[model samples]
Structures are given as structure tokens and as C-alpha cells.
Target chain A: MKLLTLNFLTCAIKTCKTNPASFPLHPRDAELEIQEADLNLTFLKNILPRLMWEELRVISSELGLPELPATPPAPADLVEPSNTPLDTAEVTLAEGGAEAQEVEETPSQTAKDLHRILLETCIQEGKLVCGSCGHEYAVKEGVANFLLPGHLV
Target chain B: MLPTPSTSHVCFDRVYEPAEDSYLLLDTLSSPSETSFLQDRFKHANSSPPLVLEVGVGSGVVLAFVAANTQSIFGRQDTLTLGTDINSFACRAASQTVRDAIKERENGRSVFLDVVNGDLGSAIRPHSIDVFIFNPPYVPAELPDLSRHEYYNTIAEGKKATSFQQDSYLLQLSYAGGEDGMVVTNRMLEQVPEILSDERGVAYVLLCAQNKPEVVKARIRDWGSGWNAETVGSSGNKAGWEKLVIVRIWKSAD
Candidate 1:
């Protein structure tokens, strides 16, 4: 038991050095995450001229986002309206209530699903860059620590 | 001599004879349509004797136009125009062009133009320039094996090329983006605050291919709330393959 524990500790330390959490996972997977982190409405609008939408949709789906629609959503539908509107009282109490919580949980669940795909499929075996500044993180033993210097803080 | 075919949406008028390098570079001002394309903007702005600085002045085509236009406007040629480029060859060519243009003019020509060999904003006095124009090189780098004539021309000459050769301006102006494509442009955007003197006129940059406008906007957003950048205009590149965008930036005066 003593020998096994010593071996485990050595391996953990090696893991720490190799996985600086600043390196990217797989190049392709890391690329997808980088795009996801970089992509947004402001970026999308400005990038529309340079972006090939078909290519973006394909990449997004590969990273597990549903393929965006073929055509742009009309201006009126720019932000899709929420389908479910709960009563104010229920909405307030629901924050404290677990009753009929399933409906309320869908969006959060969807977000989690997307997050899991990003963390697992894209970032898990992939790379995690500094989301704040697009710095790539090295990975070791599936852990990514992106702690930066105080000046960079 | 004939009109060169332009890609969809691109509106260039004069296509120069193919350079020794075979790439068809349009002199955007060589023909009426193309000249009009650029001229219309300045005319529309309707500003008088504007303080203009041309970065990457190349063969001085744009500088010549501004000089001639200013002579026509001021009626005595009393306009302040400056052109700068990193390429010594280009600088020499521009200085000669200015001298020749001035010589050809009838007596009492009043336009004042200076050509400097250096990076943008370095040769000029601070807070003295009003309009800054740049058409930067936006080509991506090639693979190690590719060896074309244009590639050779684009490569900056090294010490071996001559007894004392400096870096080529083209090499300085061109970038392969960041490791992804935003790196060089990001650095350029940071210089905007230092370059702008007043908030009235905007600093204009013409970016090409996938990098220009897109990378520029992303860099500004990353810069946060202190500055303001806007995509004031865009046009089709002479080669219909990519769009050219004109971005205007301004720094607030506290």
C-alpha cells in the first residue's frame, strides 16, 4: 500500500507539470472551442462579411450546437421569444419551490447539455483557452488550470 | 489599355499591365470609375484642405490625386499632405513622383506634400494630422514549399540581396494574421489612440480578405469601453474573391 501511494503521488505531480491547463487539447477540438468562445452576436454581425455561414453551421454542429437555420432569422425574430410564460406568483415561488420544476429546468438543462458537450467533447479531450483573452491552455490528465500572473489578473 | 474584368460587386476601372510577378493588381485610380469610387467619398465629405496622411503610399497614386485635388480646391496649392511607406524603393519613387508633378504644374503651385520612409505615424508630428488612409497588405502566408514569382517579390530582401538592404515595406505592411489571423491587426488597432489627434475626422483603414474588418472589430471590442470604432464603409475588392471594407475610428477627447 505504501509503494502504491507513492507511485500515485509521483504520477499526480507529473500530471501537474505536463498539464499546465494553458495548452489546447486536440487541435481541431480546441479550434471549435476557440470559435465558440470567440463567436457571438457582435462577432457574428461584424464577421458576417468574412464568414461562410455554411461552414460555420457545419462546425457548430460538429461541436454539438444544432446547425443554425439555413437563412438568417428575420429582424423581428432576432431574439426568439420565450414560449413559456409563468405567472408572476408562480415564477417568484418557483425560485423557492420544487413543484412543476421540470419545465423551469429545461433551459438550464439545455445549457448544461451544451456545456457538457463543450467540456466533454470539445474541451475534455480538447483544449480550454483563457476565455477572457483567447489564450490557449495546455492540458494534463484532464485538468486545465489557467491561473495567470497577478499583473495579468 | 482595355478595361480589366472585375469580379462581382468590385468596381475598379483601370487594371495595370501585369507586373513582372503576373498578379493583376488594379491601380484603383488609373481609370475613371475607380478614381470616382475613391473621389466620391472625399467629395461627399466636402471638407476643405483636410489634413491628410497616407500610410503605405506605394507608388504615390493616391497622393498624386489628393495633391492635384487640393491644388484645384485651394486655387494656389497651399495644402498640407504627407505620404509614408516602409519600402525605400516606394519612398524614392513617391518623392520623384511629387517632384515631377510639381514641375509639370504651371507656376505658383501651392500644394505641399512630403514623403517619409518609415512606419505609420512615426515621421509625422503628433496631433498634427487629420485624415489617415491605409490600404494594408492582407495576404496570408504561403506554405514552405510554394515558390512563385509573386512570393519572391513579396519576400523582404535580406542582407545577402545587397550590401545594405533594409526590410521591404510590403513585408512590413503584410501579415498572416495572428496564429489564427488577428495578431498583427490587433497591434495596429492599439496604435489608433496614439494616431488620432481630434475627434472630428475619422481614421480610415481599408482591410481586405477575411481579416480586415472582422479582426478589427473583434480587437476593438476586446479593448473595452474607452474607445469607439465603427465600420463606416465598405466596397468590393478589384478581385471579386474578397470584399474590402473601410473602417473609421475616433478617440474621444476626455
Candidate 2:
């Protein structure tokens, strides 16, 4: 087991050096697609509850996603890190609007529209996320990877 | 053109004296479709003297008509035409039809088909081709019955009816695309990016719409990224209420 771990570690290090995420879609390309969708702040307020915050943070940091809060309150002194983890809390100050009412009346419809816009932007513009899970599904070669290992199930 | 009576004990001029079934199949293909694929070809490149290939050449009806038109307009400019079908009988009939067309001189002389028989992509030289055309066998959601007359039978035979329920149904290598109607179309689209020419041409594919145009279009849109495609022409056949559509796709510089 230790030898296997060592082997995997060596391969990972080599892979990182060779093909780093320094390229576009390194991280935020998948998670921040919702931001590009001409959406209102209400969308973020409503959708924050649906995602895995930690995973979102990791994807955002890797892709250098700015305009995302580092924490729930979004402290003024909280200097943006070289990268931020996706673990920040879901709740943020509400931005009241007609979109919020639309969400209240037809939550499922809103979810679907949000999901579709997210998918289209990601696919057409290199944004990647799962169609069902809202998890970050990396896009490569115009293929959106929605792979879920057995353990995740 | 009128069908001449049997003479000289030799069918030297008729490649296919269409049997009832073959006539119906040819009619299904040649009938006008709503999506005119030829218009797309003409829209992208109107060069009249372009080289064209028609695979699975059935009765040689379309080839005969197209060749005749080209000859009348071009007057004698260079043009290359080839037709290939898996069936030897079909190839023989096509060759005979070309001979007849040449003899009549109504179409033109020196007009010949580079016809052959083999699997798709085989039997053709690489990149030496310009336009690739197909009217692939597309009867929707059919069962594997033991009818020798079926076009699927022309593709492969000997599978038991019980085998149709297996996972290999789609991979039957004949027809049947699982439960959904898009399986065979998907496999065909997957091969298009490779077998089709990328530099100066596109493939014109004809399919019968059996109430699955949306599925077909979605698959086309997905597989066709670097390529541009549109319906050129369409015609309808009364049987099965089938609508045959022609789709011509070209590679864009973008």
C-alpha cells in the first residue's frame, strides 16, 4: 500500500509539472459558469444551498474566480488568498427582486432554467458542471466530464 | 424514359430493371424531401464540374439523373463519378444503366461510374474523393424478421429472432438501434468526422424521418462542431408516411 501510494504521488507530481491548470478552465471555468448567465444576485442567493460549497471553492480558486465571497459575511479585511476554497457558507445577504419571486413561485422551473443556462454557457464557453448534481464537471475537448465514481454514490 | 421490352437476351442497357421491392426503395430515395441536401451543396460550392461519389447505389436512378444534368450543362468539361453498392446485382444493374445512358447520348458519352463493392470507407482511395453521398437504410424501430427482401437483410443475415432482445441488438451490425431510434445514426455520425473530407468538401447524407428528426438533429448538432450542416431538399413517399431528408454538411474555416 505504501509503495502504491508512493508511485501514485510521483506520477501526480510529474503530471502537475507537465500539464498544470495554468491553462483556461483550470478551475473557475466549471463552477463560475452560473455567474456568466445574465443572472441576478437572487440566483446566487437561492442556488448557494444546492452546491457543495467546499468543492465550489476549490474550483473557483483554481480558476481564479473573483467576485465570489470568501465567507458568509464576506469580511472587509479578508484578503483574497492566492486561492480560496469552496467551503465558504452558502448564506449571503439577499438581493430582493422579481427573480426572487419567480424562484418562490416556480422553484423547479427556476432550477431548470438556471441549470440550462449554466450548461449552455459551460459547454459553449468552456464552462463545466454536472447536469444533475451541480458538481463541477470539467470540460475538455468540448466534452463535459460527468463521471461519478462508485464511492461517491 | 420508357422501359424497353426484353431484347437480345441481354440486359446490356438496364443496370436495374427494378423489381417491385427495389422500385419502391428507389422511389423512397428519389422522391422530393423537405430538406433538400443538394441546395446546401450548391450553396457552399456551386462549381458544376465537382467530383461526386454515391455509395450504396441502388437502382442507379439518382446517378443517371445527376449525370445527365451535369453532361447537359458542362457540355464536355471534366467530371468524375463513382457508385458502389454492397450487392453485386445492384452494381451490375448500375453499370448497365450507365451503359444505356451513354448509348442514348441523351445524357452524354464517356460518362462512366467508378463503381465497386465493399464496406463503407473501404474500396475508396483516401482524400482522392470530393463529395461523398449516402442514402443509408433507415427503417425505424424494426424487429429482426426473416424477410430476405428487407434492406437490413442485404447488410447481414443468420441472426435468430431471440437474439434481438440481447444487449448486442444495436451491435447487430444490420439495423435496430436499441429502443431509441438514434443508435445507428449515432454510430454513423461518429464516423463522419473521419471518413468525410475536411479541406474542401462535405458529405451529403439522406435519411428517412420516422418521427425522430429532433433526435437526429440533436445528434447531428452534437457531433457536428467544426462542420456546418443544413437541410437542402426533401421529398415524401406515401408508404410508411416516410419523409426523406437530405443533409449536407461542410467544414467551416472557423
Would you list the C-alpha lDDT of every candidate in the order shown? 0.40, 0.40
Models, CA RMSD each: 25.0, 24.8
Give stretches of model 1 more than 4 Å off.
A1-153, B1-49, B71-77, B102-110, B142-183, B199-201, B212-215, B218-228, B237-239, B251-254
Interface DockQ of candidate 2 = 0.01
Candidate 1, residues B93-184, lDDT tens digits: the string is: 55455545544555433233445444444323334455566665454543121112123322246733312212332343333344334454
Candidate 2 global TM-score: 0.42
lDDT for A65 (candidate 1) = 62
Off by over 4 Å in 2: A1-153, B1-49, B71-76, B106-110, B141-187, B236-240
TM-score of 1: 0.41
Candidate 2 lDDT, A1-153, residue by residue in tens: 000001001111112223323112223343323322222222223333323344434444545544334543221122223223222211111433333332222223334333333222232124333223334433333222222222341
After superposing all C-alphas onto the true structure, candidate 2 shows an RMSD in angstroms of: 24.8
Tens digit of per-residue lDDT, candidate 2, span B1-254: 22321213323222233333333333433334411433343323224334456765655655554454443322332334566554434555564565455455533333343344333433233333456666654555653432222243123458543232332332232334334445445544655565454555567676566636555655566664666667665564456566666666667766
Tens-place lDDT digits, model 1, residues A50-134: 2234533444554566656685333223222363455535675867765545332222333333323322233323533321245
